[model samples]
Target: MIFQHSLYHIRWAEDKQILELVWKPTTQDLVAEEFQAALHNFAGFGATYGVSSMLQDMRDFMDYLPPELLRWRDIVVSPRYRQFGLQKMAFLYPPEMAPKNMGNAPIQIRGYAEEFFDVYESATDWLLTDIRPRKAG
Candidate 1:
């Protein structure tokens, strides 16, 4: 996906039903509509009838300043969360981003995804499926 915000991990899973896209929240940015549009385009490939995403681990993206660090770009992280939710599946960062505690973050995010989506072999599995024949009048 062409997201303005950086995505932590992205891949296919669960025999292709799950197109997991995990994000580690950083107050550094906001997600835009073009992001979803890009993923929507890529998902058009092949017989993979349906594609969904899993977004998780957003904390920095939601932090408001103490009247100190606040900026215009920081207006509504909460709404940004909703925008990203337009994706098939979206997971939250679950909490804040303590720079000191980032060491174990990846494991935490991946664990959440796997716990929900199960497992998949590869992106290839996401590509090949039975194509539906369009009805001809």
Candidate 2:
């Protein structure tokens, strides 16, 4: 494990070159500041370890953030991931949270690939594979 907080814990999967973040269930609501802090910490790990693949196990995550916070993640936090060479990010959610597309549609990140999954094994498997298209120079 690299970093651990009350809300989440970050783990380094050396063999797969992936960084995993497991979110813990919270009794109270999650604020944007707290969420950003956690993500900053995750980015710190990525910068330190040169992580390319990321897996977020959000099965225990139950809090909801506002649209602004979500937009903040896309505009601010995501570039940090790309800056540090992050290639693929897989979000592992519970079956109940599965999108209507059934994880078929990918989130649009200019330099990176993001996918949603309901299974841990599938998330990790996709992370380890290089099936996504490469960015042009």
Candidate 3:
């Protein structure tokens, strides 16, 4: 199954039991509202399907996240995903955009296991691992 919004596309990997969200490229930088909308969609989809693993494709995403929104992401967004049983997240970022410290960003603050990959195959393989979801207390 697939869901589409202006900022991103969400698809369910039935065989792999993971939800994949790919950000769409835009000429303008992304705003917090757009990013939040994508998160809301993720929350809704994960809740509805009870999916615990996610693969985020950021290859085509060129927007810069503002500092304030970055804080909200770590403080508010990450926790929400944890509440919805998000256990593992694989981030596929292009090599150019994937800085050395990129994995240390707000996206990794949820306390769930996460890894960054430059290739889709690696990310998908990792997400397909048999690791069970760890519920947040």
Candidate 4:
């Protein structure tokens, strides 16, 4: 099960629990509207399979979340995603970005366990591991 969009490719792995999203690089930065649309597509894809794990390949993506979008994401978008049953997300980032981008995980992903990795294989491997229940803070 695969879906392709202008901004990303979404695949529902045969492994059942995981849904993978590989973002495409853009020549220019994405505007807030475009980013919201892409995020909507992502949520819709995950809802289709009731997936528990997500592997996000962001190596080709270079845009950062602008302040407004970041606020909207944390305040609005992320809470809705939490209702969709997604428990974990593994982000595959470029090696050069591993250091700087890792700290942003908690801010970008809410109500889930997320980690950044420099390689796709390792990210996927981590997504497949036993997920312990996270206690509410």
Candidate 5:
């Protein structure tokens, strides 16, 4: 019962009890495609009332993510961009160097500040406990 899926969309890795999400928002095709998959997963897992945020590695888009990307509102909150506003606790980890109030994306309005994590595994460990995605043995 290993739920294996690889996409920017959310993945229910039942065996691992982990939901894997990766976003390639730089390109329209990747953004739209990943969002489609993520939305479907969100529907299956419940989307209406969960507070999800972006796991944005801001460094990936350092040069122009602000001017070019933030100019669009939908891009700020689009599923293609990040699976956010889902009402379930989500996370955001800006690059170590990005200033505390750096992101220019409109989602910053969510007011969910980023907490530094030493590593992804550590972050996910905390999320799994907090979110309590069903674990598989």
Candidate 6:
């Protein structure tokens, strides 16, 4: 593990060029600033390491970020991934918590390709593969 915090744990798979993030369930009051700062720190680490792909394990995360934070992530944090040369990102969610439209649908965030999976194996498989959805004209 390269980085560890109360909110999340980050591990790098050097051979696979994949950065894995496992979010921990929050036990105290959640703070947005802290979360943002943690994300920035991780982004810096990823940039330094030239991370190309990411696997986010969100099954243990229980807190709901506010809409503003979500917007901030979309507007601010995501571009940093692109700047760092990130190509693919996979999110693993619990089967019941998986988004309704997540089935076999390709999601593009900022300029990188993203996909959602309910199983860790599936998520890792997708991340290790080179298949990316072509943008629609």
Superpose all Cα atoms of candidate 6 onto the true structure and report the RMSD in Å to 1 decimal: 2.0
lDDT of 4: 0.74
Each model's lDDT = 0.33, 0.83, 0.77, 0.74, 0.38, 0.81
Residue-wise lDDT of candidate 1 within 4-51, one digit each (tens)? 334344454554444544444543453444334324433332114344
lDDT of 6 by residue, 1-137 (tens): 99988888889888777888888887146689977886787678779898888888889878787899988987888889999998888889999899775646566746888888998888878888888665623
Judged by whole-model lDDT over C-alpha atoms, candidate 1 comes out at: 0.33
Worst 10 residues of 5 by lDDT: 102-111
Cα deviation of 39, candidate 1, in Å: 5.2
lDDT, residue 69, model 2: 85
lDDT of 4 by residue, 21-136 (tens): 78888715767787787777777878777877888788898688778887887687667567888778787889887756463433223777877889777777777876553443
Q: List the residue pairs that clash in candidate 3.
A: none
lDDT of 5 by residue, 1-137 (tens): 11233433444445434444444345333444344444455444534323353233222222333444343433444442234343222344445654453222122232332333435655554544434232212
TM values, all candidates: 0.29, 0.89, 0.82, 0.81, 0.36, 0.89
Superior candidate under TM-score, 1 versus 3: 3
Q: Name the 10 consecutive residues with the lowest summed lDDT in model 6.
A: 101-110
lDDT by residue (45-90, candidate 3, tens digit) is 8878887888889898878777887788778778777888887888
* Candidate 4 Cα errors over 4 Å, as ranges: 100-109, 131-137
* Clash numbers, per candidate: 5, 0, 0, 0, 6, 0
User: Between the candidate structures 1 and 4, which one is better when assessed by lDDT?
Assistant: 4
Candidate 3 ranges beyond 4 A from true positions: 101-108, 130-137
Candidate number achieving the greatest lDDT relative to the actual structure: 2
